[model samples]
Target: MNTKTIKSVRLSFLLVGMAFLLNSCFNSAKKTETTEEKAKVYPSDVIPIMEQFSILCGDGTSFKDLIKKEHKDFFYVTNDGVTDWVVYKTPNSGITSRTSSNTRTELGQTETWTPEEGGKLTGTLKVQHVSTSGDARVAASYSVVVGQIHGKEGHENEPLKIFYKKFPGHKKGSVFWNYEINTAGDDNSGRWDFSTAVWGYDMSVVGTSPDTYPAEPEEGIALGEEFSYEINVYEGIMYLTFKSKGHETKTFTKNLLKSDFSTKEAIPQQIWDLYAAIGRDGVERENAYAGEIQNFKQGAYNQTNGKNPEENIVWYTGSETYNGDIEKQYANGCYAEVWFKDASIGPGSAPNKQ
Candidate 1:
């Protein structure tokens, strides 16, 4: 071939080779970027137990397929400089279940079991925040439910509700649990909850006035403090264990098949004072929660609401909701946030074995 023609052919081949090399490099870089994006962690990666549960958010969002998935601002993963945690957050007021006025970003167990069948749930978590603008006179103000044994049928009363509460400007807060009565009759409005303290006062403690707060708990939990709880229902009895660093480990037990308040005289005086205004004096059934189907719940069940506290002192938390504007409420400290480092659910074991 002629020298000039051969030179032109050589240049063409060189350009073709350069284009091929550039394309290959571009594809390799894109593949590396995709690999980095997929490296982002998720709540499911932290807690593989989510496969057996469904999630409900404060905005009325619900989902069951939680494998490697997360919802923004409600159910997601976060890191606190040391550990990765799954966060559940809810505003004081948002779209909620029909039977509840308060909102929640929580997990509901898909399986149901009777008291006799039993189950167990365990969690390691921390309370990040609670609604700061609530009436101190209200029992449920500035509080959130972290765990629960909730009924699935009949009146659907909760047998256990683990709570964390702190007053505005207080450095420490209280951890308590409540047992709601399964009312005897059809009228459920008269049912009441009996509370027991875990690390501090129970649900009955409240301020004397609307804005005034009581004394801060001397040995209570502070915001961002980590704790753990195990609820084991074995052979018709409920056993609870609460533990935290720098605090005493507390354990409690209650018979689930027998009624503690079957008769009118069995109601504690705290219930009389707390529920007298609302007239909720009904007693629990003789069998209590026996034979009832129940399931476990965990995460931030926000107890603060916008209802007037004077209407119902026990549950009506007159907290600022910003008219259900979640963004405004979160920005103004009118929300609840909880973070869980680990959790698990399974069949209940014997108390001795646990």
Candidate 2:
């Protein structure tokens, strides 16, 4: 071959070798960059971003703005400078998120992304319902999870799972059965005095009075010895049901508003009657004998001492007869009593005297 042609061929071969070496170096650098990028995307880094993104979206913010405003803290740029991811740390809850690009084609196209930990981003949040008047408060926690990506537009799947837990507040009072029944005359002439120390005050028979009466003790009606009482703190409703010895039943309901001792009323009728007739004499009086009046009178006197005299009286006077076969149903009386603090009563007078 000619010298000129040979020289040209040698230069071409040298240039080709240089181009191959440069290409190899470029591929190696790219591989190294990919490895570093993968390492940066750990479960910790991705979890937080996902969580913030979810919260922002749930709060009605758009995905794009959510990242900018709420997830700014968790973002990190990829080694290639073309991709980013975000992280979030939920407060008293679990983690979650959304991504700027979740599709194969768009995955690395965005300046920022979320939920790098992969799998499904999931977590929980707590919410509270606080009463404006400081009378009540309730709290609940909810859990949620993000599933697969939707279409190429990068929309996320609907929350795949959810659950909730309720937290109840402490009750603020003591409940007592405050009435007595007189089997001797089948009369329900007494009062029950219940009180609670709550809302920075004492509520009891000494404070206010609610009135209730028992239905006439029905003949052949068996008395149910056991009864149930339910108090709803939220609604402030008290429910009482009495089962007679012969299976007869009676129920009464009272609103805390009307029965609260914060008012000036005497004891509620139900409570007054209960307190009057619940003792040994009230329950076991079979014969009309001497000294009974004194006992009854003394019982009444003891009820009214110094606290609140108006709440100590039992007003029913009646009688009924039942067949001996079944524990006789004494019907003919119904009474109730409720008491509330006067708002004027100082906190010092609220303790039990006994």
List candidate 2 segments past 4 Å from native: 42-354
- Model 1 spans with C-alpha error above 4 angstroms: 1-22
Worst ten in a row by lDDT for model 2: 294-303
Error of 2 at 226 (Å): 50
Tens-digit lDDT string for candidate 2 (166-207): 111322211122212112343423212242211111122221
Q: Pick by lDDT: which candidate is best?
A: 1
Q: Which candidate is the best by TM-score?
A: 1
Tally clashing residue pairs in candidate 1: 0
Clash tally, candidates in order: 0, 78
Instruction: Mark the 10 consecutive residues where model 1 has the least summed lDDT.
Output: 309-318
